[model samples]
Target: MSEKSGHSEKKTSLFGNEYIQHYDKDGNKCGTSEEKTTLFGQTYTQHYSENGDKCGISEEKTSFLETKHYTQFYDKDGNKTGTSEPKESFLRGKYIQHFNEEHEKIGYSENKKSILGTKFRQHHGAHPRDESKKKIVQTSASNNDSGDGTSASNTSSSGKNFILWHVFAGLFLILTYFFWQQWLNKQAKEAEEKWKNEVKIIASKVPGKWLGHASNTVVTLYLTHLYGDRFSAKVNFRGSDQELQMDFGKGNYSTSLFLTSRLHAPLYFPITIPAYNKNGVVLIFRGKFANNGKRDVFCGQLIFDQNWKILGSFQDSDGSVGYWSVGECDGMPSNISGNWEGKWERGGLWNPLEVNQTRFKLSLKQEGKVFVGKVSYIGSRGSSSLRGEICGDYINFKYRYGDGVVREYVGQAAGDHISGTWSQNNSFGTWTVSRK
Candidate 1:
């Protein structure tokens, strides 16, 4: 049947004259034949059967001021049955080759020119010796010429070699990737350990309260020891940022206070100078951590005017300087002294019981910065005495809950509410209290 577009599908073309057509559900080419033009002005037309099998192709080319034509033919099953081209010398004599239903070449026709005249002679049952057939026949003869044992042995040895090479390559790559990951992990661990060491060495040296006294206000400093050598210090004062004038003071304020056999350079800690000042004296605290049987000391220095002055200078008890102890301040005026609605949770890692949530009543009294409280379950299980201390926003309390079990409460205070974790007998849970 002549081809026509079907199923509302249109032919698609990459270029003006070239088209790529798709097939229908039954694998039938349901569109017009495609034509392609080459850059050299060569045109190729492909014709497909209704079954979507390419049945024929025609190529036209112009070379050396002459036009050439080439055509190829295919069977209904899309097998190349024959071709018509004068340029191929081999096909000039054998113009056509006939094949059986199985596509095995069975015969061919050759045009011969003898003394009589040019005539076509048909040779039947004479197959063509193509490249594929040559390789098959040669391989069969080679395997047969040698003993069967030798041939099989060679094949087996070659396969074993190929498999061994691939196995070794794969294992090598896996080991390389594993070692690379291990190296990365080792680097990270070393960096963390180094940081911890630095922090620890810094903390041990500067272990006291630092103070800066100006004429109007006193700047209190508290250094909280943290993991490694890292520490967080709280500076308590109220004024414009420029009012707190500070200087590192005079002398080498860094010294090693611990015993270590190795001789190492002193490690300096970071200290920011305050802008607040009393009169014209600027005060600052400075210190350095020490290693290897050395002691590290921090001292306060007061500079009179902009130059170093001996009048306002102060230092830690390093024989020539004086120091003061830092004190805690009551957080806010809002005292947590009233009845509160409380929740008590009973499970922690140390407790064997399933976690339970219960309600309780808490009575608290605050005296200065100290907290004394009692908590009782709703069913009157008897209340326990509580004692704790509040530091800034942090509150910590502990109570004995009858059975020799001590419950500790640590949390932050938020106005009228307190929320924190509670731990008892190695078990821990959270609690919340709101003013009632």
Candidate 2:
């Protein structure tokens, strides 16, 4: 029979082959016999049979059983360059192997391990210490038990933490921006409100007045109407200084001036004639007027109101000789209501012979006097109007003639009489009226 089938074959070898072969549970020969061997000065022995089979074939020891331990060579930069099986002359303890460009072992570790240790410490010092490195090592061991690499966990955890940090930071930034914008809008609104209130407070301190004027040779007048109606005024030149007063029919007169009222019936005058009435007898006079020896006889009509006051007088000749009764009068009358007269002089020369009149008219409706009228003459030129008042004294009224000339009068009223200065253009003059 062949030696493989012999039961008592000689198994002696010069390598001292005391070993045991391992087998699977099915009794199949799974490994070779174990034997002890020595290489270099280290005493590690193989745990396998002479046929290259494992002796202790447990799962935990499979890697050691299948691989042979060999010395690896590295460059000074710690890059692996060569590998070799351990030999009899190999040094024990920690050592570094040196290799050439061809990956051949050219040198071995010497006392230079001190230098490499120093370099390793310096490298660690230069970089930030990873406090999680120990945990990473433990995790690596756990991964090795499950046959997976440890690098995947480190990569995944790092990426997850990085994304989480960015998301939180982005949300914080967005909220901050919105809050800042709202604060700015609030500030702007408050500022605008404050400015508007300040302007209003400043504007409240101004005075209220319509308009006024002043002049040397003129009396400026501003007239306002209470009742809205249009009236007319005419200035007639009756006669020069010391002229006879005679009856003149209609269509005969000298010079006549006419003025009109505004849309609201208020007359604004800038001038006035200066005079005042002394006697109170209201005279109704008709005369022929002359200017530079040119004469024109003018016929006129006179009337008074129920208060024994002259209302107004109208002249048909040259449209001159109208008079407004000054005092309190309500309506028209049939005759002159008061005997009123006045005289004026300029540059020490008597201006002309002129008749001025005033009268009071009783009001049938209200408790106070109503109308006031006045008239003045230079040659045949004169103006007249009837005025209304509330306080009876302190009269304010306006008059305008057909020639668009407006006059405003404001003055005081007394018993059965009124006196004030009328203004037109840049001239002013005193005037008075009385009851007949």
Candidate 3:
């Protein structure tokens, strides 16, 4: 039955030191042959029986020198029986133990004590009372011994206190915001009240009325060195309603007169008297003054006011001795205050010829009782200038022509229209004026 006699299969040991060869009944190598060995530095060998059953295993310390192999034998129960060779090595500076099939150490030797002995023992489940476990147990015991439960109770109390403090802080902030808003509203109301009081005080300081007079009149009597007598009339005004009224008596009148012309004659002349708050006076007066067989209409306006009294009057007619001591209407000419355009009869009936049509334009301005203006004449003789004055609605102006002849004119102004008469001299027939 020796394998070498070819009656049994020859097999190699797993450690590569032995081989087995199978044979047939004729004692020749037959069937399949197998070789098994440990790979690399594996120092352990496991063995099986002919029936492909795991039987036993052997562990050996391998060396480089002696090519000795370890063998394992098993009974029917697959337990190791014996071992053949053992190995040792000093190069690794450590010793190893070889084990039998039953996991019992067959030979034991020490190589070196492990530096990570506790870790190794822990991995192998051999460490007693590990440090992490010990700390956990101690902590559990300490928690159990605190009889008042102070740690947990303190933490819960602190959490409740935090919630209460946060609520109180939020309420305080809300109350502060409301109080600030109330203060702002109070300040705004106070400011508005202050502004209203100031305005009321300022309104109380203005004056109630203006100063001026209602009307004034002036009359002058002149006696000639020979036998003639003359009467001069002038009016002064504060405003339109405040005026001076003059009444002339019967006398030989040769002195100049000025009148304020009116636009239209009213049924009754308006005599306005200025009051404190009532309508202010407009100095207007119209009447008739006679000389020789002709009657001339007189109109005048009061142009100045002083201390609520009429001080100056302006007559819108031509006159000499214009500036008097009462209030000088110096160099005043009677002319309507408006725009005027009109045509006049050109020539006289002597030659039965009408040539060189006459066109006239006049404007007057008044300051208080005094007035100044200009008149333009457009005719075949070209254009000329005349001085003018304002007295109510009556206007008079005169200009000297190149022929050394003086022409006098009278006109009236109302609203946007004016009309008047022109005389070549004081005795010539009158030329009519109509607003264009």
Candidate 4:
């Protein structure tokens, strides 16, 4: 017999009042009949193995005239073998017996009328050699011809705690994952705020005039902060006024720039200006910073590409049509305060070869008679500090080389033109330059 949900009937047998006889799946020898549950007169039953694993299942119910016992058997693999109807005997509604399909005696239950007029059930099955079957499911002390049997107490465990352990483990893992995701979100938010603060610090250093020196033209840039990562740019190429940058242009030659590009160290902005080359050229500036902090400089070059070579990086000057360098500059000087570039030639200079022609570029900042700025020569691929002064049409300037050597230039200025002869100690050269 197995535990059931519906009502289980009381069967009176020759022994005393008890449930129906319990047997194994094949009805051969009885396993310990577990106290599967005898509810408030319940009827359905579930069977489990010794290790708390489900093995087989069967149930039984009693009627007025007959007793019906339906038993289902299972194999080791838990597959259903078959169901059997037990051969039951109720002689004169008093004596009863239960038999298997092989007609061997298995167990039995009988009904007895008590003095209180209630029917009492008693069931019995025992073997002398097998003490397990001798364990009784339910019994009473109104002894008959049957030998005394001890009450069957459940000796098996159901492994409910093992299943509960698995349930708790799953819950714990879910909670850990939820908290981990929350932590990641918090870290991302903090990083975003830190980046914004850094940009704000950088923004304060911006919003000023930056000057670009090129072999072909000199460019002046005015930056004004508008909002987060945004600004307005007005690019004046010294000469080209109507021509505007592609991405920075609003109609009628105005601009509102978005700072989403390969950023500069001191000045970060997009530079996609229109360069007129008769075939309508556009110059996409990719400048590399020489320093990683404020007041830095950037240098790059423009290559004349008939079919646009997609602008990518400013790592080197491998392909150069005209080289350029940009830097933070003091506001435009008053007079004779612009860029001048030309070539210089001298006889018997260091490595003499007829007349060694060297290119020179000067960015001048003239104040009264004193002017101070930067100068670069073609042989010296970098710029140096320049300081000079102009008295009327006659001007004189000197630049310091990297090795602390000074080169002075004395020239006569006429409008935007300057013709001079430069001397560096015991070396001298003739030079010609003009304002860009």
* Backbone clash numbers for all candidates listed: 31, 62, 62, 20
What digit string (tens of lDDT, one per residue) describes model 3 on residues 1-436? 1121122222346786443233333444332212223322222223333344433333332236745433332222433343223234665232222334454544322212235431100011100111112100000001111111111011101112233466787789999999999999999999767544533432232112323222223433211121111112222222222211232212222222233323323223223222212212223233333323333333333322221222222222333112111222334334344555666553321112543555666555556444555556765445455565454544445666667666655444454555443444223222455544
Model 2 per-residue lDDT tens digits across residues 204-303: 3111211211111111222222121111222322222221211111122232222222221222212111221232112232233334543333221121
Task: Report the alpha-carbon TM-score of model 4 versus the true structure.
Answer: 0.29
User: How do the residues 1-436 of candidate 1 rate in per-residue lDDT, one tens digit apiece?
Assistant: 1122111122335564533343333445443344544333333444444455554433322236556322333332334433322222443432334333344544433333335542212222332222122110000001111111111111101112233466787789999999999999999899777645543544554445655443235756555665543344444432312112122322223222221112454244333333323323233333433323434233333222322121121221222222222333333534788899978676422132667788888898988778798888787668888886655554666667667666556555678887755544324466788989
| Candidate 1 lDDT | 0.42
Q: Best by lDDT, which number?
A: 4
List runs of model 1 lying over 4 Å from the truth: 1-327, 330-334, 346-354
Supply candidate 3's per-residue lDDT for 19: 30
Point out the higher-scoring one by TM-score: 3 or 4: 4
Off by over 4 Å in 4: 1-158, 242-320, 328-436
Specify the highest-TM-score model's number: 4
Quote the RMSD, in angstroms, for model 1: 22.4
lDDT: the better of candidates 1 and 4? 4
By lDDT, highest first, what's the ranking? 4, 1, 3, 2
Give candidate 4's whole-model lDDT. 0.43
Model 3: ten consecutive residues of lowest lDDT? 135-144
| Per-residue C-alpha lDDT of model 4 across residues 1-436, encoded as one tens digit per residue | 4222111123445675343333333342232222243322322233433344444433332335655433433232434333323232353343334344343554444444457664433444421111222222221111221112211111211223333455687789989999999999999999778656644643565457766644346766565766774545554532432111223221123232232212332334434444333322223333323222322122222222332211111122222222233453233323778888988877422224657787878888888878889888766688888776554554566667777766656555667888655555334555788888
